[model samples]
Target: MIGRWHGLVIDCPDPQALAGFYEKLLGMIRVQDEPGWVVIGDAPDRPGVALARVEAWQPPKWPDESSNMHFDVRVDDRETAGEKVLELGARRLEGGGETFDVYADPAGHPFCLVAW
Candidate 1:
């Protein structure tokens, strides 16, 4: 059986941009960086975000199409993180108030900020 989740691979138009957003929002660091690929992690060992630079990346049709997957980023300050992600160019999608805030990255990849 699977013990734990290692990481999640995200398809985006810009890996660097998406990775950068996650890095700032989650306070994660780039554990690995290469052409066409980037990985971010909370610590030196635990992986969090794995990003791929796709040339033909097409964002999922929002509020209509079914998303194959999505991510939830738990944070201490939902408001702060939401503002921070917005400043980083992420678009607000759903959820708000004191509980959580959902946002879509620059490439339209959705993620959530949950109060920690």
Candidate 2:
């Protein structure tokens, strides 16, 4: 069977902040907002990144640590995207080698930026 992933759920302390980070990063907007949840996407009527805030938020350990999953992001300019992401509250997690660099999102979820 072939399955298409719908969206990614990011757990964070502040849904608004995280959602804003992704909204700017992906050129998306807030589609839904609730007490403890906020979703951002290109189209409000379609599926996209879901930022779900929960009590007692804990960040995943990366590099030397393990995480359940991670996503790879394609960008036109890795340097520019890295800078923007950092400005948006994400931190550089890994140095660039040839094609990509790793970053930790606002809530410390690791993802990579690949040049497209």
Candidate 3:
């Protein structure tokens, strides 16, 4: 293999809040939390994500323009998962096909709940 995947890094206004949202959303544990940085993972050795705070962050309006990155979470039940995410402060985004539903996190990052 070329190299191991480390983790996804997300930029947001409040790293803690954004990380907390993902923690609840994905059941990922918070491994480390600093003032402007938050790390989350499923296990001690495995890779996860680091949420870093960025000043004057602007949320991308997906569909209007191409998103630099996006998350795709697989779920057994799409409708139920969508509802749960919506309850967790995700705004519904347009252009979700039959296989998946799109939403924007509290930080305005786009993510999808995939039934496939």
> How many clashes does each candidate structure show, in the order listed?
0, 0, 0
Worst 10 residues of 2 by lDDT: 58-67
Candidate 3 structure lDDT: 0.91
Residue lDDT tens for model 2, 1-116: 59876777888888988888887777898988997899888887678888887788877766677777877889988988889899988999855568899998888988889985
TM-score of each: 0.81, 0.86, 0.94
TM-score winner, 2 or 3:
3
Off by over 4 Å in 1: 2-4, 94-98
**Over 4 Å off, model 3:** none
For all candidates in order, the CA lDDT equals: 0.81, 0.83, 0.91
Highest lDDT: give the candidate number. Answer: 3
lDDT per residue (tens digit) for residues 3-107 in model 3: 999888999999988888899889999988899999999985789999999999999877897778999999999999988988888889988998998899999
* Residue-level lDDT for 37 in candidate 1: 93
Q: Sorted on lDDT, highest at the top, how do the candidates line up?
A: 3, 2, 1
